[model samples]
Target: MTPRIHGGTDALGPARWDFSSNANACGPCPLALQAVQQADATRYPDPSYTRLRAALADLHGVEAARVLPAASASEAIQRLTAWRARAGDRRVWTPPHAYGDYAHAASAWGLERVAGPALAQLVWLCDPGSPLGQGESGAAVQAALEGDARTGVLDCAYAPLRLRGASALDPAQRDCVWQLWSPNKALGLTGVRAAYAIAPRGSEAAVAALQALAPSWPIGAHGQALLLAWAQPAVQDWVAASRTTLAAWAQDLRALLARHGWACAPSDTAFGCARPPRPLDATALRARGVKLRDATSFGLQGWWRLSAQQPPALAALDEALQEQEREAVR
Candidate 1:
């Protein structure tokens, strides 16, 4: 039998195509690259983050007082958890198959944690929830907060595909008012650790009080300057171009997989989860150079999450799937 030519499927070795994380496969903003390169390495990055905070504040539709920058989005969310889980309330809530760091951050606070639907104090949603890549509507998000309102954290870490409303989670439903946004997801600055979390308007004291618990500077002067440059209109176009290319390719790749025996779905963002038509596990397929993330990690076991952001990935995926089909039939 001929090898299937699924788009972006890694039929290579471990991390064959890095379908696990959602970092951009396209490229980083040249302006960001230049900024990092031109950074004064000897000088200490201003932890004050005056410029960074201001930039993020404008995007968030809040005062610079309402915004604070931490080392990573993890730092932001974790510190927020530490603040809320103070006293006797030591618990953080997350959806089943959420990011491990969310739980890790909560645990650092010595707080109790739970996953899957709940009315708990701390609730974490991917905005567009993950493994499925579907975003929850803003109203529904508000409802979740109002249901309890203790400390809500919107993990829009994946929302760059379509972006979110500036004030989508305003007024703090559970009196919860923290939103996590990682610039690395859309900007491909993964190693830079460029990430942030926004608190409500009156959360200034909470932010200041929680500062000691927060992590130090993440991206440094290099990352800081780069992020600002990326915020420009020209760089924004680069992001848009990448999105359009990936979106069209994703649709085509999904269609290609369906045409064969593989069952899959097109992702709303760059990631999509689907099962192979054959009786093969994601791990077993790895031996064939098709290492994909086991959906089990995302609470979607028996399936795999594949990234189709590059030109060569689709052909690789198709080839891998075809091979799998032949082996299964035999």
Candidate 2:
């Protein structure tokens, strides 16, 4: 298995000022948290996920048959790659800089990574993408949708957390591909491992095949409760309101990094990549309770991916940077 590198809690426990993960800083949404905590752990959710599928389908305004739930976004990636490989798909295309899970899944299924979307049997796209938080190019989406034979999966993981700009794929275009959504991050409950995908229009057989390959009860009761709560208007409202706060924090974060001499990259979501004025002592920073996501895994070396934090966390980061500078001078 390809080694997995991710953000959030580590061996030392969660960071005091964690800019490493893109989860909504204002979340663990109260409403969602209540639902999860009250979940009926004694009973099993419908193995077929009838009600859950319908809820997700209704949320997206799609048919119930189109909804396919998974353990998480990474789980969905692996399952899709396996399905494509089983159908003799030999090539996969992913954004130049994207979630490592895409490439790892392709490698596991023995699918060759192609240079362009048109040359591949499977294509992956992310909007308000991770690390950089940029939207996928329109041309890439078009290429993925050009052929009926090709399978396209658009990662909508960061869509709810988007702080600026609109999606590259509009409603009609999104219906043309698999829309993979993991709402945990937006709900501020990333600990809940649940995700679902909306299959492209008229891809029932493909959906069924992937579903058959899945193990029983891909999501547990707590996950089911979380997904159910995600469809609630109150929860949606909370998420929307949080975005306003997050946007302001993102702006403040950019300014903070700029003041410290770091060059930040533009991002539509709350998280973005930035280059420190000088090499950072990451271990030292961690020891001081600060953690940042290195962008090297996303193929961007010398840049760190950071998410907007609350003022207190931001202040802590400022202190950490100043300390680093003082140490360098000494």
- Cα TM-score of candidate 2: 0.98
Tens-digit lDDT track for model 2 on 207-284?
899999999999999999999999888998999999999999999999999999999998998999999999999999
Over 4 Å off in model 2, which ranges?
A: none
- Residue by residue across 200-308, what tens digits does model 1's lDDT show? 5577886787666665665577667766665566766887777777677667767776777567754567677878655565565565555566676555767877665
**Estimated TM-score per prediction?**
0.82, 0.98
What C-alpha lDDT values do all the predictions have? 0.64, 0.93
Q: Compute the lDDT of residue 57 as modeled in candidate 2.
A: 84
TM-score of 1: 0.82
Alpha-carbon error at 320 in model 2, in Å? 0.2
Candidate 1 RMSD computed on C-alpha atoms after optimal superposition onto the true structure: 5.9
Model 2 clash count equals 1
